[model samples]
Target: MDMQDIENKYNKLIIRIPVFLGLALALGIGIGFMISIPRKNTVSEQSSKITEVLSLIQNNYVDSLGLDSTANFAIQKMLQNLDPHSSYFPSDDAPLAKSQLETDFEGVGIEYEWVKDTLFVLYPAKNGPADKAGVLAGDKVIAINNENLAANTTQNTLFKKLRGKKGTSVELTILRGKNIQKISVIRDKIRSYSVYAYAINSEIGFIKVSKFAEKTDLEFTEALKKLVEKDKVKKIIIDLRDNGGGFMDRATKIADEFLEAGNMIVYTKGKHKRYDQEYLATKGGIFEKGDVVLLIDEGSASASEILAGALQDNDRAILIGRRSYGKGLVQVPFELSDGAEMRLTVSKYYSPSGRCIQRDYKNGKPYDKNLVERYKNGELLHEDSIHYDSKQVFKTKKGKKVYGGGGISPDYFIPLDTTDLSTSILNLMRENKLREHASLFAKNNKKILIEMGLDKFDKGWQIEINTFRNIVGNISMNTTQSDYLKLYYKSYLAKVLWGNEAQIQIRNTQDKAVLKALEVLK
Candidate 1:
């Protein structure tokens, strides 16, 4: 062939060869698709699939579904898969959730308990809306805003009804003995103090911190001031037994009060460097010179752990009770575009000894059932049952060994007391008979009890065994159980008449952990 004829043939052959190879490649792909199993979805694909499914449901579903609700639920489920702590709060629930850690909220401000579908006023908060409206303790709430509370009326429903925007009014029909009185209570801002402090004796002061909130450090400082200045308390017991924690800064601030200057309180490390930071104690700590003891348990978590870990690692305080709730994860709240809020776990915190106290959540293990597992493994009752990670050990400032990969173990372990937890006692507690009995006793002798006061009642009053038997109805109990029942009755009575502080004071007379704390302080 000539040069031109050869060039034209080569170009035509190249085009034909590609066409043939493309056909063969298409055939091979079709055969492979027919025989191959489906592979797992990629991260991006799975996420897109979720959005597509949600869109499809919104546009084409048979029934009308709330888009916000659906999206909120999906977000909640997604967060659940990430960790136990990360959570999504809907717009309606966000305020209430945040209010738990707020210093105050607008409400009628009466602590109540439901007895036999009847809402009983435990006590109206001093100078609060209900108190200003002359709502008395022992009053039964018959109705709210003319809506009679039925058997189906839940506590949450009642709470919503009682709480409203500032300057709003809630009309309550209260049954105070035989008199049914209609009272109009104007809801106003009520202070919800997180710290309850009182001198247990001449030398020992007890402070119970329910949670870390916006004003927690201020409240704690005031508490310490009173204990040290007015009460002349040389030792203090910080009771953080069931505090679930709140603001990290509040906890670190309280830790600073106990720790000396320049001491590292806690440090956080995250994927992003911005979330990584260290909290150190500053100068002029109020209670730096006192003998300090902290009481913690499985319910004590997050900020509670932070404070306890700081004190224990520095040997500044003795921790007494069960191991703390193992949560070292630091969550930061982010507001979504739809006004919803999400608390995402951003970092893990460590103590001064460089130990992260977060327990293992690997292999899809049941993390929520950890406390139950601890109970099952006899860890709560026996110190020997605790399985510490051998390789995760760290030392305190005093060279004492502490372990990570779990929680902050106390220097002294107080076993969970099941001594007074008899079947009869349990039944009484479950049936609310004990509280009912206490309520009735307080009501019948309200005048006498009020006149005599908590001190005299603590010193002289005793529930007769016959009276206890009559209230509980044919349940047999040992002397120990009976004594415990009496103690509880008195404590509940004290709570109804006085307040939580008085109740704690009464209960601390028999509280093993409190007793241990006092011993450590001494």
Candidate 2:
């Protein structure tokens, strides 16, 4: 019990404790490293195996192939094996896609509608190469650089021959206004105005945005300015039908235009990053208080969903038409080492109201079956047949109950109508009778057809039923009731002499959805 003996015992105890604690920690570290080391080695081995396989394929193939194409194809095949959404774009395709998404390209700018291997100019872009070259609307491109493009050339081949670097010249043999004339058009850098028609009619401004490209917000702002300059617009209709989507930033920008300051437009979260970016509207805007309506359909996707969801949740616009295409997944384009790109799904996009508009794609299965399943369950034909997610619900800014897991359900549901679609018409279209007849009629009256403008032709063109019937009768004279077929051919002939737009207008005159939209707008 001496003091010196107690002090010596305490010091020894402390030293022993330190030694034991250090040994325990070392053991734990050793165990952790042992577990992880195998996984690291396995991954490394797999990577080596992939490299070996690729090398083997490169060195020993059944046929001689371009190494660049083979590498790109391998990348594409690898992505395809992973998921349906992940896609690869080769070098040649990348530029074209980049130009399209960025809303700029080098070419003669004209929206041409293809029919029966012939390119007919729909409308020349203002201040575009085609416009500068005096390439009028309704002109037919017969040849390009001594090659008869109208004969049997595919559109892809023709576009390759036409599109080139900026300032490059393309010589075209065009049949314009009843004259076969050759014209040279120097291809220039063409910027696509996403908002095509921006005008004010009777104090109501109209701005039509075709796609959510890179220049969408800029173009949209310009459109708003133009419309406001013409007259004060009280109402606006944003057409989102058939637009598949584009840049996510553009969607956020567009949504920010309508929402109030500090409002959440959209927020995305992933495993690696918990991104909660809040997009706010700037102070100045043209139609902050004006009425807005959004038109949507099954074709409307990703960026379109962002726009519709933001506007809807904020009570900024009345949504019209059918349910949107539920594509709430965010895709990040990763450029491969071999000049190829892969669009991989990195995150899921959510609306301001916290609704993920993406439908179920569990088990690595494609969710494209949703629409077809909906149709089979009798959704498209009638509004009553539509199903909503009753269990999963989110509240809007105004406390309205909104569902998740599917798509943006419009405030007003418009049923798809198929009244005018007949078996006879479908048969004729499928058999290429309509296209064939139009080509024949155009050939016979090429001189007269070239002189007609879209407006005049759309308004004045009528089928001479008797003349059409006689022509049809002459073609199928040997068969019985061939004479009766002539009248049917005549009716379609009127559609051909005009444009496909005219035909669509005539056919969709009784469309329930379009009529419903107009009625709601009015």
Candidate 3:
């Protein structure tokens, strides 16, 4: 009952591994093509035959690859023929994959970055595990649970080693300056806020929503209320830069706040009539009549496109920036028998003016890399590089022409600015030397920096060019590079404390879109 039984079980597992691998491999094909209820007879028959073949292969395949791995590989390859957003999440990875939308993670809270193959502590979440255990900036994370992560480690590997269920503990070996110390960290649930910027000034307000997550609409509405209802600002700027959207309902809610009742916020269509739906502003909007400026960029996608397209098509707000990321496919989730989750494209979203903001994926896989092609074609640097067909054009409520071949072309296109940036400057930023310097400055001048606040610090406080040159360590900086460094330092310095809203609000002074928007507003 001992060795013989174990050997038999192992042999069975090895023989049946192919099915697991095939199921995993084919997982991606199920994403974006999910049917909640059940498939038709023909579809059912097709699935049965596929399963039978996989079973046969599992029992007789010469190689004994694990079932799950083989299935995952097959699914991944299959998805290449579909849209980019549809994806498969293996059972072990499903939970963590949903962390961003969940807006929290079970882990010892800390912001971290890997530089030159070594993990560096950016800052610990206040009162979180690392902070509570005396982790410090400039400290090198050498090992986790004495596994020695120093020589070779990826961000993914390090993150997995650190995160677990709440109240679980992990040991860390840290090298701070000269001394090496071992610390025990207890992991806990850490909440991540999506709203990165908000402020009211000059009879105008600004808010930057980084992503559309679970509470994004709540955050956006609260931020707008703070600006309009509380501060009574005449105009507002909603910055949706780098927002790779989340829930469609959440985006609809956010768009609803800015649109008048009866306005079409967005709509979606699928093969089945049930998947077809429309969202409209059901009530009077909060800032319905206010002069609004929406800032979007190449990174703005999904629900981001919905809100921006709604506002733009309604002629409610002026879009200021480069074209948004065109991702209009709607995904529905299904759980596999093995507990893995799949997101399949069930529908396609359309902006109010009837523009499908999905970029053409017919060319091939890696549709997301269209941005790179756009850059190569100088689309980022010039609007002339963007070829919009007349058939794809639509008129706003105010008769303003908007193109929708893919992505929203802003009313005001702000070209990418790489001027005054050099290798030296990039190196400084890459190393986060300014962030490191700012951390030290914040510690040493915590009283003064905080007392001064970001506004005062930006305008009045003088950290000086020499301070940057000294901390950055003899790096040759031209005048442009030096000036850029000063602003970079100022931006980091503006963030006297991590999570301070003042940083973005203050740094907008240097934003091209903000400046252009101000011109239009004036």
Report every candidate's CA lDDT. Answer: 0.79, 0.62, 0.73
Q: Better model by TM-score, 1 or 2? A: 1
Off by over 4 Å in 2: 1-44, 114-116, 132-136, 139-143, 147-156, 173-182, 197-203, 274-276, 363-377, 417-518
Q: What tens-digit string does per-residue lDDT give for candidate 2 at 334-376?
A: 5556665556554566888899987766655444444455555
Model 1 Cα lDDT, one tens digit per residue, 1-522: 132332332332233221121121121112222222246578679879989989999999999989888988989999888866677777876665655666788899988867666788877887889988988776888899999998898645776899899999999998866789899999999888889888989999999998877798899999999989999999989999877777777888899999889999999898777667898999999888889999998777778888999999999999999998788777666666677767667678899999999888775767765665676688989999988999999999999999998888998999977644455555566466666567667767889889998888888888887887787788777677777888888898898788888888898998999998877777
Candidate 2 pairs with clashing backbones: 469-486
- Report the poorest 10 consecutive residues by lDDT, candidate 2: 20-29
Model 3 Cα lDDT, one tens digit per residue, 253-294: 888888888999888888888678888898867888889999
**Using alpha carbons, what is the TM-score of model 1?**
0.85
Q: Tell me the number of clashing residue pairs for each predicted model.
A: 0, 1, 16
Highest lDDT: which candidate? 1
- TM agreement with the true structure for every prediction: 0.85, 0.72, 0.87
Q: Is candidate 1 or candidate 3 better by lDDT?
A: 1
- Candidate 3 Cα errors over 4 Å, as ranges: 1-41, 52-62, 150-156, 364-366, 419-421, 474-476, 496-498
* Model 3: per-residue Cα lDDT at residue 456: 69
